[model samples]
Target: MNRLLCLLIGLLCISCTSVAQKEKYKKEKVYTVSKTNAEWKEILTSEQYYILRQAGTERPYSSPLNKIYKSGTFHCAACDSPLYESKYKFDSGTGWPSFDRAVEDAVDKDVDYKLGYARSELLCATCGGHLGHVFNDGPRETTGMRHCINGDALVFKHKESKNE
Candidate 1:
């Protein structure tokens, strides 16, 4: 009986330690240093509001860019900076929009070692907003690159853009 009780105590200690470690690993620090409430709201749409400002992702297949393949540049919703041009885009089976690369001075790539793996994270240079992840697994004829971006983070401007 005493042995059974000791074993139970040991198990409980181990479980508590594991739980604490998991929490430490998954902790996300939110910064309140940048934009104010009205600034963020004024710069973002409802969907962009949830994703870029709140770190949320849109449901797959819902982005109009999934069907968009025209001559235009995709801009950051927050800053109106050119991100991806229509020329580098391709249909990557991962579902979220894919591009071969980003426009110059548009994306800021940081080495992300999240989830115990090495990856490059894409962000808006101007606002430090999360865009998405980039991968090397792409088509043969293509740049062998995949810039899997979040739809809510982008606002597509058609080629010969009338909105300019």
Candidate 2:
């Protein structure tokens, strides 16, 4: 009877450890744009600092970028790294700027459990700033991934046509 109890306790410990590990955020080796907190604060607005530096979420449908469908490249507001091209942008109706994909190698994903649930948190590879979360329920015709990015974390550059 004692042997069976010991085995059960050991199994329980292993499972608990795995769960704890899964909830921890994994850090990347190096970010291209590193800055002090003071420096970042000087450059970013209050809302941008909250969303990017503190990992806070913006209110739904509050961003003007939500309605912009113009052709352009969206770059990280903090570091100016190109994140998503307009070609991959989509209206997911979730009230944030949704994209099917990000530019190749422009972002890194980390496991986040800030809200008591595991989520894929997108970060700027250049500055390690938090962008938002990525979900699986996107357009079936494309990657089927909805990168629900925070607009305060991005700056759009309108691509001018040659017709000018």
What is the TM-score (0 to 1) of candidate 2?
0.87
lDDT of each: 0.81, 0.94
For model 1, the stretches where C-alpha displacement exceeds 4 angstroms are: 1-34, 111-118, 161-164
- Evaluated with lDDT, which candidate comes out highest? 2
TM-score of candidate 1 relative to the true fold: 0.70
Please give, for residues 39-91, the per-residue lDDT of candidate 1 as tens digits. Answer: 88886788887777665668888888877888888888877788899888898
Q: What's the count of clashing pairs in each model shown?
A: 2, 0
After superposition on all CA atoms, what RMSD does each candidate show versus the true structure?
5.9, 2.5
Cα distance off (Å), candidate 2, residue 106: 0.3
